[model samples]
Target: MIVAIAHSRAQLGISAPAVRIETHLTNGLPAFNLVGLPETAVRESKERVRSAILSSGFEFPSRRITVNLAPGDLPKEGTRYDLAIALGILAASGQIPHAPLGDFEAVAELALTGELRGVRGVMPAARACQQASRSLIVAPDNVLEATRVRGVQVLPAATLSALCGHLKQTQRLAWAAPAPPYAHSNLAGQPDLAEVRGQYFAKRALEIAAAGGHNILLYGPPGTGKTMLATRLAHLLAPLDDEQAYEVAAIHSIAGLHRAPGQWLVPPFRAPHHTSSAPALVGGGSTPRPGEASLAHHGILFLDELPEFGRRVLDVLREPLEIGRVTIARAAGTVDFPARFQLVAAMNPCPCGYHGDPGASCRCTPEQVRHYHSRVSGPLLDRIDIQIEVARERNWLSSTVTAQLESSASVRARALAARARQWARQGKINHHLSVSELSLHAPLDRPTEKFLAHAFEHYRLNPRTYHRLMKLARTIADVADCPAIAQDHLSEALALRRLEVAPAWPAGMKH
Candidate 1:
């Protein structure tokens, strides 16, 4: 007899349609064989299936049993196939009826005593099952995560025996309804923007960055609240919509970092340490997974102490920053992860941290200062849309002033209004606008056009940097509620770009 059960495996960014698990009893020496390019985890599921069958008081067939994961060309990984394999063997041996197994997509990792364990990427698997119009049988531990996807009949199984009992009509498992997703509130653990004591210029730049989904770089001496301000940017972002929530949650579940009992509603804030490797920051493994950048998708990626990281590691992010996705090609195949994130990086002016500080004198030589700043490549700096220098002032922090600054909630309200206006004017946000779209929507007025032409010649700006400056100016215009980008907007945008001018190369080194 041969018994086949249906399952699924995630490939690239989506779940492949279906993988049928078939167990056949054939005449040969007593041994078990698994086929269909099963990875080590899938192959190892055999021992677990055997132990679980016997420990659950089911007979293990003595004949040579060959288990084949159908659609043989498809590469299968993970312990997700354990339950399907076990059920196929049981139904082949005629212990459990095959009719019930045919209706549901069974996915779980089984222990020797038949206890079902949780598996990764359950959210995506559940969604796939729903799309296929099939029921999902998940381990009790995974039910919490799986229930995040609605419109699916979720049967949470405690153990393999429990599933068998239910399928055989001896007992039944309870159905789990979808869990309501939770939204992150500005009043929660988040710090308010009003708490930032000073640096109004930096605060305004933060507003523009959040409004346009632009990347920002803050260069200043130590203790200027660059890190402090970056942390509050998420609070300024509007809450994720339902579809965006599920997308973010699904990525987190696959990464095994989903928050318990609730979903992430607000944009996620990921601050990977400077010591993170290229793989850890960008994401890769034997089985490629979402890295920090992808995990920060639809959210913020904050890098403090920017120049301290490996130049190569920082360089790895340039491609994703441009394309909004990261592709990791392996022997298995190519897996692409979403890398659309707003980047906020902070750095010191020099190695000694006092190059331009009004509060202190610099010790580093000119060459040393140049080397320290040069660690950040020109190409990377060009990608950053807004750049600002934070100069220290103690008056804002003094006891005499008690006036309140705008809270994150207030700032977010203005930001949402600005975003709605921009999106309505252009189909997408300002940051996503292409060159053609920019020409149509942000056509510069005569005065602004003349100002940009003069600045381009004086500052020696490249075409890429010119586009970035115009985009930033468009964002500023959006926030100002102006019908057309004006000369002041272009002037302000150019001021930000000129804040940190890269060192001029030696006479012969100019490209």
Candidate 2:
């Protein structure tokens, strides 16, 4: 009797937990039994591993070989364990030395022809290997992504035979070096604010949102450049720091998203269509995968035509917005994925395309308009820090250029400076500050305090709304380079908070 063990990882949400593959051989009827809660893909690895070993010029021991994934309670899934299982068989059969096998971890899918296939969602495993301080063995195709984890020793093998030769201490494989850090240029080629004809107010709102990572809602009639403004928000923001870049890349990699190499450094901007289902928006499946929000972690989640999305679908954002994480639960268990995304949503003024437009008349009735806006519940709207209307630019065609209307480059520099101030003061952006932290960090003087109190009472503001308003004012102060919340900052934040305050959404609807 002989026993062998190899290390692998099991995919759970965005996490990859260590899995031990134990293979044993005994004197009994020729049989191969795999245990320990393996799903379809893992169970099928038996034939794949056997064929790969035999095709690679290794003897397939015809014994009652039993394989077990330890911690039988943990569900095993995917073909990522194929290489680990094959190596276990060889080490147990005396075809390869067993001692060195314990020094490394492996993740690869095996081809029947003895070639190695790259496994999806191996980035988490690569990180786990690095954290565990273990050298990771992967296919040549995966070396690029595996090396994304800086300082993790990696060996890329083209075939099982190649890997076996190296493991035998006969022909050692060359280890992979980490790829160079991706270089990112400051928002140079992206769309510029100067391209947009006018709407200085909307541009200012965007600048505040970018500086503080606050969620914003843009409401107006058609042709107001709402979508255009929302798309350019990414340009006004800072590039992802090293930690943020890794998190974004890891999330995308786990979702099996195809990313061209340097693109990972740029902040992700995901704008899902209104017709997407709730599960698609919030991330739901039998096995539970990441949704658009998780994919937008450390980035932007833009939803255009906001009211067109179902109320139920929109409601899924309530938790992730407040907690900065999304939890998907199935009969299997619950898995949480990071969802700290800045939301930028745009909606029409009413059911009719041109409800509030001075040039175009609205046909939507009062009831129809109410029903349309009702699609976005009050709770969800409350979570949004800035809710401002984007009015149609009437004079853009004939308007003169002014110094106040700067390019996105100028706005981006201001936004970055504001963000630097926030980070230096609180170690985080204004939006993430807790209620206590917001109170302590954003101190209002006697006059500003009285103004906010009077406004809150006038609006019948809820506690959440009041706190969000303060945070918004704090961001406004940050933008102005003010150390404390000023009266002007409070006034501007108050003006932006009202959803229908700016001439209403198509201000009046006929009953």
Candidate 3:
């Protein structure tokens, strides 16, 4: 045979797009040519494939060789195509049967010794192959990740010769067993809510945030346990469903992150440092990759020392916070990554970290405090559903105080019950309810309406803020297991909007 074809996949964002590997041998001077919009790494695969094929005891055709990755418009950028390219060359050279390549897709890197190596984004490729109703061939290193996708037939190959032997019927590769079932809940290593000494209000706000998937900001003096409170919020969250777990796993896989099998269903928690760039916070680059926001999909994204991050970097989160995805556009194309993360941020009241505390004297003028708070934009603040203050607990170290604190399991039980109510009532979480849906699910009586209107006008809330306030009230009511938004719920929701009140910082200072 002078020509042969093999199937493979390319990683684009979290998606695996099909790429056809076409190889041909012609009567001419000995040379190898690769065509398609292949990047540096993929271009280097030619040498790797040549070495791998020779090392596998296969004859290298001396005729001119040409390889093309079809759908030339889509850019190819990884070593994942090496195995398929080598297989195509062998098939075209009549060293392996080309007929058997029709039923399978391969994605793995090739070593100089003809051994197969694992590549990133195997989970996505496995899913795509399963959807296409084709079996997948991968290295032993990727077998577990590929098998994680249910119903995908994964054949683990150790070397090119072994795979060729299997294809020729001289030997057979065993199918990998399916991965173990995902655990529904994994709070084993999570910090318990009871570990936090005090800050009942902060704990309540965290509970509300987890129950309804609301974004929260916890601001206070240093050593007030804001970070501690933020870390515990993920444990209170409900486990991801099967589909969500797969989505989360695929995103992490694309980013080259792996977690223990037991933690597959547990919500992800990501805390990027203040020094992280905008692209690092939101996914972006010459070749776009999943950033921290995308990594936190179906989970929590906690930003400690929130104001310490660049203002522009923080602003980049506004879009993903509003819509549950981040769209990064480059000259090549635009990629969208799922970023439906529940944001939990911690910050001090001032640069000196003790502006409002009675125990410490103010170090700078009010302007410094205003400027520090202004680093966080108003639009960004408006998108956050709950903004509460964490205060210092003078006697929290006392044994008496620790005994009264609730455990994470207890809080998670209540939070789960609240979420169940939300799901039953509106078929979605309170945080995701649209304005129209809110009217139907969270109707308010006349008195409560009047009370909310007075507070809204008094605070000069924007439409977005008003809607978020309503969502927060609905969440509060759900936590209380109430069917309707009550006056008390509205009142508590308003109070949780710490920026809406005076003296915390001037309301005008937010802009």
Which candidate has the highest TM-score of all?
Answer: 3
Error of 2 at 195 (Å): 1.7
Instruction: Give the per-residue lDDT digits (tens) of candidate 2, residues 1-511.
Output: 8999999888777678999989999999988888885467655788899899999999998898998887777756658888999999999899999988887899999999889998877788988888888889998888888888788899899999999999887898899988887778457678788777688899999999999999999878888889889999988888887788888887787777855666767888899889999888778787677889988888899999988898899999998998999999877678888999999999887877676678889898877877887788888887888988788876787746444568888898999999999999999999999989988999888988898888767766666677888899999999999998888888899777756344343322111
lDDT of 2: 0.84
- Report clashes for each candidate as comma-separated counts: 0, 0, 0
TM-score of each: 0.95, 0.94, 0.96
Alpha-carbon RMSD, each predicted model: 2.5, 2.4, 1.6
Candidate number of the best lDDT: 3
Clashing pairs in 3: none
Clashing pairs in 1: none
lDDT value, candidate 1, whole model: 0.81
Clashing pairs in 2: none
TM-score of 1: 0.95
Instruction: Give lDDT: candidate 1, residue 315.
Output: 94
The regions of model 3 sitting more than 4 angstroms off are: 39-42, 457-463, 506-511
The per-model lDDT (C-alpha) reads 0.81, 0.84, 0.89
